[model samples]
Target chain A: MKPDSPFLDLETAPRVAVSIDGAPLELPEGANLAAALLAAGVTVFRHTPVSGAPRGPFCMMGACFDCLVDIDGFTRQACMIEVSQGLRIIRPRDLGADDVDA
Target chain B: MSTHDLIVIGAGPAGMATASKAADLGLTVAVLDEQPRAGGQVYRDVDRVAALRGDILGADYTQGATLTAGLHHQAIEHVPGATVWAIEDGFRVSYTRAGRGAQIAADRILLATGALERPMPLPGWTLPGVMTAGAGQILLKQSGVLAKSAALVGCGPLLYLIAAQMVRAGTPPVAMIETQTRSDLIEAARHVGGALRGWPYMLKGLKMLAEITRAKVPRYPGATEIRIEGTDTAEAVSFVHRGRAHRIACRTVFLHHGVVPNTQAARSLGVSHRWHAGQSCFAPRLDVWGQSDVTGVFIAGDGAGIGGAKAAELAGRLAALKVAEESGRLSTDERDRQAAPLRSAHARELAARPFLDRAYPPFAGALAPEDATVICRCEEVTAGDIRGHARLGCLGPNQAKAFSRAGMGPCQGRYCGLTVTSLLAAANGTSHDETGYYRIRPPLKPVTLGELATLEHSAPDTAE
Candidate 1:
């Protein structure tokens, strides 16, 4: 991607291609799910139901729960969740009404 | 079934005074504090160590025992080491005690939770031996342990108090760097004239100044930079005042720019906050009676603003009186009389805070630690990481967190979120609060993995 921009030193940390939201994406070693998503410019982490307002990371820890997104098949704090190759991120609405966890 | 008509969330001057007044009205009042004893931070047992060596830190802390004992006699259940996590709707409080979760319900809630020392960042602040002045004082008072030799810095009344306390302890400070200028010291004398009715306090301030003068601790006013140097532990600190460099060869550094309202829990509850330009932090917006916009929830003491202990106590009693009026327990005349002292004290505190804040606004360099310094100790992310992400056009804290994992930690960014956000704002040349902290959500404390597993899975068709 643009000859690595001379920014990310992939030699220090290996590069890995991880699937997010079922889409293949390449990330570096030791990169967290939240950071990888942000580096790729996927800022809108989730959306609220009633008003359908877009929401993203706040507090960036498991404390806020603002960065919660459905990964693989379960809803979890994206800040706490780390990135791995071939992982899936599902949207809240896509999880269906009955399967939601509050 | 131990129930109370009202539950106050601190036993400091504010909580004690409020409980006293509330108990006088025949309401069962319960006070909870994280400390094993009352008196909060201000009246902590600092001087008792002096008594061990036969010196007078003063009688103010000792006199507080009467107020605490009086509350105890009023049938008030003072639960110590009770960390309140959240105040739910209908006044249900979920808290942790002795490492177990517990719940209690109350008719009315007063948060007199007092203030926490504002986090002032400097190079090597994350080092082991460098601590907030509050932490050092607490250690000395609570455990009879000193911080070995120390270099105390920052500008505030507490600096003078701690300096005096250190002198009395027979181990005077190696160096004391003041951020306030000689002009501010002169202004303090002038400001105390109108507040001379509290002559005892004015005299105390004078006596402290005299001690500083006599000790010749080399007061450096308008201190700009504080450089704490060490690896894994603090070895020494260096600062610049005027145009000269002053360094202290000491093992410990006690620092506090000023106090700020502890609004972490309050803000997470969606209780709106007003940015107090004076304190440079957002404090809970409260009316004269300390009633927040959230109905049935009241804030008092330093939570409303950084008034000292005296004003905090007055605010607590006044808030209770206001609550008494709203609950039909007091008439308008009674309410006015009860709140008179608080109104006056609040005015005085407000008048003094602006001058105090401006006199020592975080010495530009103290705004954020160097880019190489670790901003988030939990994730071990440095300021460089945050800056790198910012260069890639990451707009906000959330975006930066995604790129650097700076705010992701067990402490949950409570310690680092504000710092990282401030750094982001500065690097991007934006407003400070514009790069506001990460949003707070539910499960305020770290819930166990077993507990999460225990929560029943949502049904497939359920709406919530």
Candidate 2:
């Protein structure tokens, strides 16, 4: 994977450990989950259910729900969620299969 | 429910201004915002981000510091991270803060929810690396990060603004693919005289353009037929420029047409809205003082229309002044005297808007993307799916949504509402206004049933 993110230096900000798909990674604490994941060279946040197309954060604000991922059993927008220690994040294989009734 | 003189939803420039001004006029005000901090999207985390990277983010962002500071007035109560789920009749607001549900009643309600980037659906727009230009700017503002090399696509002031900011942060884009044609520039020239009244804004845009040009960034103007080519993520962008086909290799592609008023909250409250052909979106109808047709309900800022921040601040203050006067807190004479100067300033600030709107109208092709292009990111609905549903007797956006599930995802229609409406209009052979938009219902945002069940007044009322 290419290093797309410019903020790779973790010394300027506080660092915390997080798991993406069960793989441990260190990200800046208080940074948005999408940014942290992108910085770690993790794109393709989730795959769509309809066509199995890959998607990532589009709006960055909460408006675009393309960055939805499983956080602790409940799906949440990665752009809206913040990074914290020992946070377990899972990228869904298929969004349609993981649909939970609201 | 605890009742107050006023309840302001959103803590952006408009909401902050309204709350502070209303509090100053002796009205008890409570401000609720979803973000952990005030300043909305434009001024997100201003206090901290400005202090850390003031030079990088620029003065336009640091200016938000003043509004965020004003929100700290002693007379005003601010609630951060509160998601307002519903607004009932009699100005009752239901919200959840930190997973706990609560309700508040107010004599007046002001919605300053702000604007959203216009949806620009295109080929491969759903790919991982394709995101909005505003999203790139938000990353820079909130986390001081940028992509190593990317192609900045689309048009409008925000495209240039983000490109220049990226250059300042030492991560200039590999290329800029601007979609505005020579004719658009000629169209904009007619309004130069009126736009000159807002010279500072014009100069700011010029400075950004100059900066990008000086950096020697490759810019392709009048580009068309843009297609992002990548299977899993955006690897390259191909477009036609100067009657020639060109492809730029890059990992990221930022798309932005312009911004539209975020009208979901207001619409859900049953406030009447009309299609704003100038900006090409639906805006809630409001009086000069920002009051809606619903009594005691007011709307301010870009949520009403794309008036920018300065205009939003003035409009916010004017709405608060009207609220104060209507509640008997201020004399009509005092209200008039205070609002006169702000009105003039607001007009001056908005003078260039007509030119900007005409110069960079929502990219026409973006509204009606190709058949295979995804229009709704949440449901993965394609433009073909929507048009197919329209042919099956879908009358408007709401009907199309029910048939295709384009606007039924967690986003609820924020991203796809405008595009769906336009697609329906085209398919039905009607104007966007006649095609209409989604019929919004609460909880406006996705709220858990557990959260609603925990409301302070969840028990049924036998008295009723």
Candidate 3:
């Protein structure tokens, strides 16, 4: 871990490599996916399907949908997911197959 | 189908307490929570993160261990990682759990879905690095994460608590840009005597402020015209403080304007809710026993209203006591006897609410921000668009939903319902109650089609 890591007393766990937006990064296994992504300097979680504006996890408690990311072909809340090995994540251009912005 | 005498949704303070108490009264209970752990947001992952979070988050968080521990009773089945999407007429709850779907039957239902942090819908809030105070707290609680030198903006008691927690974590915020004006404080003075009766709550706030002050964190009180100035990401926070334009150079901005009941599940249950002007949210209309207008349904904790965790615990137990009586295990007289102390204690906790609500009222600007600020995080609907809908005769939330798709996002208006209501009310020259809230439908949480196919019987009762 970097000495200037954003986490406090971030204990060493079995780190697993995950591909976020086609970039390989290591995250602490079983940690929050959203927080892990943020710690790894991946800030923009997704782009709004409407305007394509960049957005990240805002509520982290699953209330806001800002952290919606495609996890290995499925869309889910990153905040609600625990980090596991080899999870492929991406920001979906379309919120769903049939998408409309309010 | 798994059947229980009672089905409780959420594993927060309210749900856990209700399940444990009802089970002890000999009614089989099951608690379905979305998280893998039992502790709701307040005590989230307390068991795993205890050593890292206890000292920083303080005893209030550590206390969640006791509440979660109560879920261990044999009569109480705690189902963690369950996302309940629909509740049918026969007290049937359909939820997605562990990559599959399941249905449970119960004679009684309790919802303790807790509360959502009021969305701080200011300009650039949708930008990267701008998140809620609760969100930052969750990162710290769940994973010992902290964004360095972040600035917290908005008005609320939780902001101070979060700031103090960050200070204790050795990552104190760079500044606090509070939006509560002097007049707001003066307006709250009338409730001083009432709030003083709840001195412990008041004292805790003062102590937190002292902690932040000791750390020498710069605070801008009564700030106005606040804006997050960034093109693609949150680079800095600019606001008018003390009648002068000021900008704080910071990478991360945590915005909060207090909390409101997470009413999505309860509203989806088809219960009638009344608009609360003080909190500026809609709370379910429940009787003294926490029974909603719907006969077999009950609400407790913040889902019932915005009582803090302690009060939520007491209210949960009170609701459980009534449920116990209705389930035929306990008598009405016994229920009343047991509820006596809890009721008084619960009343004491809420006594401090009026002053706090008025003093640190939701930032007027953030609640109805500039035309450009995004109100609906999921749909990216701006305030100006919602106001325009009102100008085009969008009289209520449901109408605004049709006109602008303001509440149709997957999160389903949980973040934008209040703002949409407020904007329509303001534009149409009506009160919030008159403007009304979105008539929430089922599938409260998004359920995947893969999960839905696993259901053995009919389709979801929700209208497409």
TM-score of chain B only, all predictions? 0.87, 0.97, 0.97
lDDT of 2 by residue, B1-464 (tens): 77889999999899999999999899999999988788888898898888887887799999999999888888788999888989988778989887788888888999999999898898888889888998998888887768877899888998999999888888889999988878988999899987899899899999999999999999998888999999888889999998999999998889988999999889998899999988899999889999999888899999999998889999999999999999999999999999999999999999999899888877767888999988888888989999999888988988888788899988898888999999988898998878988999998877887787778863355124
Report the C-alpha displacement of residue B38, candidate 2, in angstroms. 1.1
Could you tell me the TM-score of candidate 2? Answer: 0.96
Query: DockQ ranking from best to worst?
Result: 3, 2, 1
On residues B1-464, what C-alpha lDDT tens digit does candidate 3 reach at each position? 78899999999999999999998899999899999998999999998888766889998899899998899999998899898889887798988887799888899999999999887788878888898999989988888888796999998898999999999988999899999989998999999987898899999999999999999999999998888877767889999987899989887899998899998888887898898888878899999879999999999999888989999999999999999898789998999999999999999999999999999999889777799888988778899999888878889999889888888999899889999988988899998888889998888888888998777764355425
lDDT for model 3 comes to 0.87
Candidate 1 docking classification: incorrect
lDDT measured at residue B223 in model 1 versus the true structure, 0 to 100: 79
Candidate 1 lDDT tens digits, B1-464: 24577889877788888888887766778887755457676665332333442243456556666567667655588887565666676676666654455666687888887776665667776554566677555544433334447788787777888788777666677788877776765655655544455555556777997987788777777877678787535678888888888777876678777777766666666778755665676688787788888887788888788878777777877877877787787898988986776688766655555445555565456556677776675566777788888899987888887887766664566656666767788789987567666765555555544443433333332225
Docking class of 3: medium
Candidate 2 C-alpha lDDT tens digits along A1-102? 335453332225788887888887888888888887887788888887777778888888888778889888777888877788889999988656656633
**Rank order (by lDDT, best first):** 3, 2, 1
Off by over 4 Å in 1: A1-102, B45-55, B181-203, B349-351, B428-433, B447-464
A1-102 per-residue lDDT for model 1 (tens digits): 322220112122466777656666776554445545544545456654423434444333233344667776666666555556666786455234444645
Tell me the whole-model lDDT of each prediction, alpha carbons only: 0.66, 0.87, 0.87
Interface RMSD of 3: 1.8
Best DockQ among the predictions, by candidate number: 3
